[model samples]
Target: MDKMDKDEPRWLNEAELNAWKAFNTLIIKLPAALDSQLRNNSGLSHFEYLVLAALSDAPQRALQMSTLAVLANGSLSRLSHVVKRLVKHGYVYRETAPGDGRCTLAVLTDQGYRKLAGSAPGHVEQVRSLVVDALEPEQIEQLRHISQQILHAMDPDLPCPDRR
Candidate 1:
């Protein structure tokens, strides 16, 4: 006999369930660990590091705040708050975009560039510690393919972040 719950879909198969549980657990745990590392060492959160890194990588070391919000997977309000903090910390400066006075650009300061450059190697090592070192090469490939397939179904128009 099959039991149905109003809010739940079909039961996940064993393999699917295992994968989902693994991903979910990793998602919750990895961020906390990374956030702790960043805060203790750099006086920044993981998301802040991400924002600075993304801007540092941009051509002019500047990006539209809306675009940055998408790249950071943060809401506009949330991004504004973080950007405010970054500006206060002397890491980022904001200015109105040339063509659109309404749109704001976050420009990474030289200090911010130095901060990202300093933090990145440690961050990469942390990522590797949690993920790459734990996975076999074949499993890594499987993860990449599975993630892309899920993302494609969810967002056909927007390419994956890694691709962008």
Candidate 2:
């Protein structure tokens, strides 16, 4: 074994470095790709689509703002900006929760539901074409598993449900 060099900073090994670079490339490129696809097909940004999708999955198509932020994989400040845009478009409505009036809820209006329903076909096709179709089923499963492992290592306390 080589002598330990105390003055040098520890860095990722080759495998680790390649993995990190690949993931970093994905983080940089995937959003722009998805946004372009969404905008071209639906006149909506990726962020807007995420907001609608989150609300559509909630009970009665409604979710608290804090919960929406987490589920949509966005910060509250970002969600606020998106919500304002959605509100102006008549796609969503925000109000105090019925049980706890202080808690804010973002409810998917009928317009929002329709818009998501319309965009989903194209979105699903884009996802399959870009991601799912590239992998065998086993590889897809491993990807999900590996992604979960890395996510857990990075965020030990975040409340993530099923990795899907």
Candidate 3:
């Protein structure tokens, strides 16, 4: 007989349960470890580093705020707050779009560019050490596909970040 009652919901099988547990653990711990490294070495949080890195990669080091929010995988409100902090720190500036005044643009300052350049090596090293080096070549490809699948499921309309 099934342990679940007829009225109860379906639950994970043992194999599924184990995978879920490991996935959940990785989701929780990976960010913390990355965050600690960034905060300790660069005085930036992981998210902040992402925001800067995204902008740095943009043409003219500028992007529409909305686009940046998506690239940074954050809500507009959250991105706004981070941008405000970056502005205060003299790393970014916000301005209205030329023809589309309704659209706000985030421009990464030279300071921001320099900061990102300085931190990038450390960030890349951490990423390689913690994730890339840990995975076999086949596993790396699998990870990319799995991540994209999950991202597509979550928001099919959202553009893939790495496609740029």
Candidate 4:
């Protein structure tokens, strides 16, 4: 009800300011670091790796192309481009879904599975170095909670599946 408060800009307090800065830094830096490691060690970009990993976890190592785009947090166009590259590399194959003529499915081939198996160790190590090992166990739990909270705020309808 105070006119003075309404006219003044709402600014972050010290703790909020610090937290925002740290979060901003992570959003900027973490992807680049992961991308660098994947590119150097496996000749895969982080997005490609994410796409492959999502497929790897799917039942029968296959998923509808649209489902995959959602799982990989990519647009349909981006997924199409990535899938094309993967197909060229013999890592994946695409075909129409058996029961659904309109839906396309992306399947991981043996070669793709083997490639992923080979590259996984290095990628896991990089993840550990960059994230897991950087936090205490409790902090890791906090991070998971915080991340889920943010995701919920961003899109309440989005599913956040727990990895086994």
Candidate 5:
């Protein structure tokens, strides 16, 4: 709280630096690994898979575009582009929300559902292989706690799809 303390750069300590480096590496590598598995197995990017999965989890397999964006952790514009691609592939379609002309709803088509169903097993297996299987039960719980804490720190209002 002193002036000198405030002026000094608060750099990471040795332990903090090591933890950060390891976490940074995981951050860089995990997505690439997941994306590779998804692309190779299902011909979908990780973001695309997230979009489809979010829609598939929704009531009537449809959600408002804004809600979908939040659930997918993507920007509205990015969701729009991906939805357009899905539409072109006969996987999704957009329509004005019933009784709400201003809101656009993105609905997953039957084809999209089928694609997601087909993709889920492989994705789950890859996730298990890479993360779940690597951790003990206690560590899994710890990891969940740590992740939630970090996510809460990043965005206190972040909505969890499962909780919703």
Candidate 6:
């Protein structure tokens, strides 16, 4: 088998180029839109909302910081910084895991739960208005499949959140 020359790159063709452009635009714009909505309506960034929501879904409303990072799609360092902010807001607290002295856990306080509950409706409406309501039922399913394929290509072992 002959090796391909390094100078010959596999460039995207016309249709692929157009698709990439559209997808790239979406990737750039969607988060900004969501973050703007979240900031304006809930006083939270998208990542902060993700962290709170992840904790809210956990059993006992707590999770190990490392696990929380994965669920929130953030680095441990980034999670640590955000957690600090949340802690200062009286939204979340940190403690040692019950049986694991070396591991730390993040717990949602009652105030945190109420904040999440209050913020959820507006966030959900923003999501629905921006994405869900813009698609037909079949397109939504196709979007899911397409997203899963892309995610799998990025990291086969990445854990995606369960659909409601």
Which prediction has the highest TM-score against the true structure? 5
RMSD of 6: 2.3
lDDT per residue, candidate 2, 1-97, as tens digits?
Answer: 3456766678899998998999899889888988999999998899899999989988899999999998888899999999999999999998999
Per-candidate TM-scores read 0.87, 0.89, 0.91, 0.92, 0.94, 0.93
* Stronger candidate by lDDT (2 vs 5): 5
Candidate 6 accuracy as TM-score: 0.93
Clashes of each: 0, 0, 0, 0, 0, 0
Please provide, for model 1 over 1-164, each residue's C-alpha lDDT reduced to its tens digit, 9 standing for 90 to 100.
34546657779999999989988998899899999888877888999998998898898999999999988878989999999999999999999999999999999999988888888888888889888898998998777887788778878976776642
Model 4, residue 34: what's the lDDT? 92
What's model 4's TM-score?
Answer: 0.92
Weakest ten-residue segment in model 4 by summed lDDT? 155-164
Q: What would the per-residue lDDT of candidate 5 be over residues 116-150, giving only the tens digit for each residue?
A: 99999999999999999999979987887788778
Question: Which 10-residue window of candidate 2 scores lowest in summed lDDT?
Answer: 1-10
Full-model lDDT for every candidate: 0.89, 0.90, 0.91, 0.92, 0.93, 0.93
- Please write out the lDDT profile of model 3 over residues 22-126, one tens digit for every residue: 999999999999999999999988989999999999998899999999899899999999999999998999999889989999999999989888998998999
- Residue 157, model 6: Cα distance from true site in angstroms: 1.1
Model 4 misplacement above 4 A: 2-9, 161-164
Q: How does residue 91 of candidate 2 score in lDDT?
A: 97
lDDT (0-100) at residue 45 of candidate 2? 94
lDDT of 4: 0.92
lDDT of residue 30 for candidate 5:
96
